[model samples]
Target: MNLWRRLSGRSRALALTSAGVLVAGGLVTLPVTAAQAATQCSVDYVTNDWPGGFTANLTIKNLGDPLSSWTLGFTFPNSGQKVVNGWSAIWSQSGQNVTAKNESYNGSLASGASTSIGFNGSWTSSNPKPTQFTLNGTVCNGGTPPTTAPPTTAPPTTAPPTTAPPTTAPPTSPPPGQKVDNPYAGAKGYVNPEWKAKAEGEPGGSRVSNNPTAVWLDRIAAINGTPNSSSNGSMGLRDHLDAALAQGAGYIQIVIYNLPGRDCAALASNGELGPNDLNRYKAEYIDPIAAIQGDAKYRNLRIINIIEIDSLPNLVTNTSGQAGGTAMCDTVKANGAYVNGVGYALAKLGALGNVYNYVDAAHHGWIGWDTNLVPTIQIIKQAATASGSTVRNVHGFIVNTANYSALTEPYIKITDQVNGQTVRQSKWIDWNQYVDELTFAQAFRQQAISNGFDSGIGMLIDTSRNGWGGTARPTGPGATTSVDTYVNGGRIDRRIHAGNWCNQSGAGLGERPRANPATGIDAYVWVKPPGESDGSSKEIPNNEGKGFDRMCDPTYTGNGRNGNSMSGALPNAPISGAWFSAQFQELMRNAYPPLS
Candidate 1:
C-alpha cells in the first residue's frame, strides 16, 4: 500500500492573443470565447520539499458549471516543476515541461468540486518559491494575467545539476508462505463430514482434532476466518453456524464488543451493546450467543465471550479516576456503571453457565500501559474467582497485546506470575496466555516454553478485521502501525503465528497454524469475526474496504474469487470472496489438522 510520487520534466509557455496560446513542443490554442473564459478554474499550490526539492500539490477548484472533465495548466515555481506521476487519477506533461493536464478515469467532477494533483520536483536551492503560477490560461491565486508582464525565465548560464536517478521502491513482501511458523501450515478447504459426525458422536464432542480426522472441523475456524454478514437480520448467522458445525466446532468464541451500555472502565456508552434500554442488550446479544453454543450441532463449540473492556471515555475515565483516587470516586458518583461494584458483577458473569466470561487484561487493567500493572489482573482474577459460581469451563481470560511491543511486554509479567505463583484455574484461569497471536510462530513457541505453557494454553487472535497487516504489529493494545513487519524485518513473529488475519485485501491463502512442537501453542482461534464492519471508511480511507470486503473482493488482487451473489457479480469487488472461503478452509486444515 505504498504511495509513489512520479514526476515529469517539462516547461509551459503561454502567449496572450485573440486566441490563448499554450506552447509545449507544439502550439495548442484555446479560443477565448465566453464558454472557455467562464469554465476557468483556479489552482492553489502547496509544496512539500524537505532537504530535497518539493512536491507541488495543486488544489483545482472549478469556478464554472460542472463539466464532463477538466484540463488544467500550471507553471512550476522558479521553472522548477516536474510531472513525476499521480494516482486515483492520472497526469501527463509535455517532455521537459512542467505544465500538465489531468483527466478523471471514472467520471466528471460537479461544479465547485475540487481535485488535487501533485508532481515531484527538484529545486536548485532550498525552499524555492514560484516565480509565477497559472491554471487553464488564467493566473492562479487571483494573480494578474501573465500577458501583462512576460514570465521571468531561469538564467541561461545556470546549468542543471546532475543527480543520481531515483530508484524504485523495494517490492512488496510476498504473501506469507506455508510452514510460516507452525506445523499446521497451508492446509485449506472445509472440514471433512465423516470427522464431523465422529466428533458430534463423541460425548461432549470437541473441535480439537482427534484420531487423525479431517471431517470434524469448520474451514472458517481453521483459517482463523469469518463469514460475511449477509443482509438477513441474522446476517447469515444460521448459515455461518452451519458451516462452523460442519467443521466439528466444539468451542466457539463470540464477542459482543459493540453493544450499548458496556461500561467497561466506567466509560459511558463505551460498550456498543446499543443502549441499556430494558436490558435489551442481554436479550439481543447474550441470548443469541447462548443459543449458538447451546445448539446441538454446535453444542461442542464451547462459547467464550470476548468482551472489549471500555469505550474511549470509559477507558479514560476509569484510568484517570483510578490514577487519582478521590477524582475517580467523584466521577463514579456521577457516572459509574459499576456503582454497585465491578467485582460482584464480574463474579455474576463468571456464574453464567453457557458464557465463559473473558476479560481484557490490558491498558485499563492490571497490566495496562499508563494504568495499573499486573496487580489489576490479580484484583480482577480475585473478584471473578470469588464470585463462587462453579460455572463449567470458566476458562481463562486473554490479554490484547494488540501486537505492539509495548502491549506485548505484559505477557512476561503474567507468565512470571503464573510460573511463580500457586494460582488455580478457578482463581485466575492459570495465566494460560490470553494475549493475541504473534507475528511469527517462533516467537509464539518461544513464549510457550519461556512462559511455561503447553499447546493447551488458550492463544486467541483478535483479528477483528483481517490478519495483522501481514507482519505489522499494533503499537499499543488498540493502535495500528502500517509498517509491514514481515517485509521490513525477516521472519514472522508469534502474532502472525497465532493466525491474526489482519489484512484481508492482500493476496494469499489465509494464515495456517504452524506445527512446531517447540512453540507449544494450543488452539489458533479467531478472536475477530469477518462481516462485522470495522467502523472506519471514507473520511478514513485506510479503514475502508476492510472486514469481509477486503478478502472477498477479487479485483484487488489474487487469482481466485470468493463467490458470486444473486446478481452474478462478485460480492465485494476487487477482493475475491472465493479467496476468503479458500483461505478459511486453509486455516481450518491447519488448526484442525488431518489426524493421521
Candidate 2:
C-alpha cells in the first residue's frame, strides 16, 4: 500500500518531464520510432533506495494495442547491483544487463493498461536509474500525464491461495505446536455457513465468474469473518464462540452490538435494550460474554473484541447537534449508558489477557469533522475512566464498520463550495480533517496515545465491502452543490439517504485485510462480511427479528452522504445477516484491486 518514493542519500526523484524538469540524477526516458510512436506507450521505472538495499518498481504501459504477451528489458547502470527478490515478473541478470519476463498470469496487456512488478535488490556504490525501457522489443517512450491514456490500472491479480497460511488455520482445533505470536496473520477470518449455504446452492450460484450481476464469485465467499450479533438470537454469540473455539482458532472476532441505546441515533440497528437499561446491558450482556471469554479453558485463543459500533460517535453527533437546544440525547445522557457500557465491556473483557478491545470510532464521513472528533475521544476517555479501567483496557479504535466510507484518503475529498480551491485534500493531516479511514485511523492512534492509551495501541478497519473501486465506484465533484463531489468522483455513494444505514448498493470488498497495512493500522478486517445484508430491505422479514429500516428500500434514493438525507437503502436485499445473493455476486465482480 506504500507508494514508491526516494530515500535521502543521493536519491533521484522524477519530475514531470513535460516542463523539461531535471531531477537529482540523469533523466531516464524511453525513445520510440515514428510508426511505434502512434501508440506512444510508456514505462515508469522507480526505486526507493536505502544504505545497502533498494526497491525497484517496473510499470509497463499499453498505449497502443492490447497484447496477449509482453516482455520487458532493462539494464542496471551500476555494476555491483544484484537482484534479490521480486514479484509479478521473472528476472534474470547476466552481467549488468537484466531481463524481466512477464509471469504467466499477467503477460497480457489491455489497451491503456499498465501492470507493475516490484523487486528488492542490493546495491553497492550507488543506485542509478535503469534507463531505456523496452517492452516486447519496442522501445517505450515516457510521457508525464495528463497523457491521452492513463498509465495505471490495477485489476485483481490472481486467486488467493485457497488454503489459508499455516499460521492462521490449521487442520484441527488443538493449539498448534507453536502459537502464532500475532494471532491475526495472513488475513484469514471465520465464515458463517449460513451465508455460504445461501450462496452454494439453488439461488446461490458461481463463486467466481464474469456473469455481470447474474452470479459471480464474491470475495465474501473467500475473505469475510462472521460477527456474532445479539439481535440475531440469544444463542448467536455463544454459538459463534463455540464454533470458533472448535476450529482451534488463534483469533476470534466478536462484535458487541447490544448497547443499551444501541446505534443511539440510527434506526436499523436499534437494539431491544433501551437507554435506561444500563443494568441489563452490564448484567445480562457484558457479564455473560466476559465470563465465557475470561474462562481459563480458552486462554490461548486471542479474542478480537470490536466494542460497540455507531454508539460513541452518535453521542458526539447527538450532543453536538443538541447544543443548548432541546436535548435529543436526554435518556442516553441521563443513564450515562453509552460511555459506561463501553467501559464496562472493556473492563470486564480486558480482565482477560487475550481479548483485544477495539471501541468503534465510526467512519471518516461521521467523525472526520473537528466538531465530532473532540467529543468522541472525550466520551471514550470518560468511559474508560468510569469503568475504573485504565487506557490499557482498550486496544485502539475501529473505523468503517458496516459503513461504506472510502478506505483510502484521496478516493474522496472535500472542496470548498464557496472557494474554487480544494478545501480538504487527502494530503492534509490533522486529527479531525482526514478525508478517509486510513488517515483517521492514524490520527486516532495519536489521539489515543495522547489520551493516556499506550503508544502501541493499533486500529482495525472493517474492509468487509468498502472497496468501492473499479466501474461500480463513482468519479467526481462535477456539477454538484456538494464539496467532495470531485473526490468521490461525481456521483455520490449509491446509498438511498446519507443516514439510512442499511443495505447499500455499489459497495465492493476493500483492500484484503492484512495486519500492519500501515503505521497505527493494526489490521484491515471484514468486520461486516459481504453477502450478509446490513439490515433487511423490506418488512417482509424473516425469523431474525431485526426491525425494518426504510433505508433499505430500493426506490428511496436521495443525494449526498451526510445528514441531508435519512432514507438511502438499497433494494432487494435480505435481513442483516442473511445472504443477499445479488450483493454477494456484485461485490465479487466489482471488488477493488479486483478479486483474484
Candidate 3:
C-alpha cells in the first residue's frame, strides 16, 4: 500500500466625493451621511507583471458594517486584458467587467477586517489599472459610482520597466540568521551548478537551467562527498553551501531525506538503515548535518531543509489495518521509527536559527480524503511535538514533493457539475474533497493552524513536474454528457489514475520557482530537481540501498493504491535519484505555460 499516489501592493487613494465626509490625513470623519455609511470599503490592488501576463493581488478592507458575504467588482481598462485564472474567490468576467465572490470559508467580514484575493491575467498592447471598484453592489472607494466611460490610461504607477517585476526590495539580510517570515522572500535562490550544467547540456535546456532547485542529502555519505556518488557528485553539503556563497545566493534548499526505513510503502527509495536504525540515524545522520548548518560561517544563509518525503503519510494511509496497508509500513509504524526519526530530525535541524525546517506533507492524491486528512495532520502534530520539538520547530510544510500532482486544475473544479452530477462523483475525482494541490494545501494550512500549529505558518508546493500542459491540456470544460466524461476530458492531470506516482509520461515543468505566489503559499518551488528519476524502470541493483519498485516500471500493472492501472511510467529510466535524459526532454517539451 503505497499511498504513493499521494501524493503586490499598491495604494491608490480615491478622492473623497460629496457622498462621504473626509478628515485630514486620509481619515474618514465619523457620522457620515446614510448612503456613505452603508458600505464603506477600500481596495488595494498590486500586480507582478511579466511580458504578456501578470498576477494581481488585491486586499479588500471592510470599512463599514460587517457583512456575511461580499462581491468585488471592477473593470479592465483594455479589452485585450483578460483574467486567465484566479484563486481565493470565484472569479468571473464579462467583456471588460470582472467580479470576484468570496469563498465559503472567507465570506465573513467584521467591520475593518480585510481579505486577500488575486488572479493571473494576460495583456496585449498596454495594461492599465482599474480606477473604480465596487463591493456588494456598493461603490467601494468612498462610495464613488462606477464611471460610465473608460478612464484615461495614465501609465500604471506600479508597473516595472522590465516584463518581470521585482517582488521585494533587497532584504537587509536578517542579522546573522534571525528567523524571518519567508526565507525565499527577497532572496536569490541558490542554483546547483551541477544541475545547471546538466540542464544546459540538453538542447533548449537553457530556458530553465538557471532556475533554483534543491540539493538532496539522501544518504549520510552525501553529507560529505563520496567518490563517484551520482547524487551529490563531488559537492558535499559544505561544498554546495560554499558554492552558494560564491554565487552570492541569499538562500539554499536542502532535502533532509534518509531516515531509517524510509519510504516503507515504496521500495525505490528504501534507505541504507534498517527499521531499527534510529540511534544511527540521529548520531551519524542528523547530528552531523545539524552541526554543519549551525556553524557560524553559514549563519547568513537562509538554509531551508525539506525534512523527509514519503515518511509520515505512511502511518495514515499504509499502516496496519488500513485498506492498502503494507507489511513494511505496519512494521515501521508499530516500531515507531518513522515518527521518532522525523521528530529527531526536526528537533535537531530546527535548533539552528538560520535553518527553516519544512516537513513533507504528501500531496492531495495521497491523503486528501476526510478519513486520511485529520489523522495525517495529527501524526504530523505528534511528530512535531515529539523528541523535544514543538510546533514552533517546524516552520511550515511542503506538499507535492517529488510527485506530479497538478498545481491547479484550471478547467475543472470540485464544485462543478455536469449533467446534474457533481465532478467529485466522476471516476477521475473519486469523491476527493480536493480537486487539485492548491486547494488542498490552502485547506491543510488552515486545518494545521486549527490543530494548534502557528497561525503564521505557510505552505510550499513543489511545482517541479506537474505542469500537465502541451497539446493534451484541455481548453475549457468538457462536454456535459456525463460526470466522468466532463472530468476526464477536462482534467489537466493526465495520470492513468490519481494514485499513479512515477516518471509520468506527458508531464511538464510547472510554474517557475517564485516567492509568495499566492495567499498562504510561501512559494512555488522546484524541490524535486526536475530531471531526477523517481525510480528505475526495471530492477536495477545499487549500493545506495534503493530497491526497484514496480511502480516505476512501465509494464507493471497497478497496485491497490493506483487501482490496478498501468504504471504510466516512462521507459529506460535510470535508478532512483539519477538523471533520466528522456524524462527530462519530455518534461521540457510539454511544459505548461509552454516554457517561453
Identify the candidate with maximal TM-score. 3
Please provide, for model 1 over 17-117, each residue's C-alpha lDDT reduced to its tens digit, 9 standing for 90 to 100.
Answer: 33444433345444443433333455554443333443444556665556575555544434444544332234565543355554433236666676655
Give the runs in model 1 whose Cα sits over 4 Å from its true position.
Answer: 1-233, 236-239, 258-260, 263-278, 295-298, 309-318, 321-357, 363-371, 382-393, 401-459, 463-521, 530-533, 538-596
Taking all chains together, the TM-score of candidate 1 against the true structure is 0.33
Candidate 2 local Cα displacement, residue 383, angstroms: 0.9
**Whole-model alpha-carbon lDDT for candidate 2:** 0.59
lDDT of 2 at 416: 42
- For residue 257, give model 1's deviation from the true position in Å: 2.8
User: Residue 260 in candidate 3 has what lDDT?
Assistant: 82
lDDT of 1 at 491: 16
Better of 2 and 3 by lDDT: 3
Lowest lDDT block of 10, candidate 3: 1-10
lDDT of each: 0.33, 0.59, 0.81
Give lDDT tens digits, candidate 2, residues 397-497.
78888887667644344434324545453222222376567777788778767867666677888886777666756554444444444433443344432
Residues 1-596, candidate 3, lDDT per residue (tens digit)? 00000001123334345434342224553333345445578876655444565556577888777889999998898999998655557789999999999876578999889776666577898777776677988666454333343344644678456667678874332234456788889999999998899889889999999999999999989988766865545688999999999999999999999888889889888889988898778767876676567554576798999999999999899977776788888888888888888887776666555678888999999999999888899999999987656687788999999999999998888899777788888877888999899999999999998998888888999999999988888888787899988888888999999898989999999999999999999999999988889999998878888899999999999878888899999999888888889999999998987987
Model 3 spans > 4 angstroms off: 1-175
lDDT of 1: 0.33
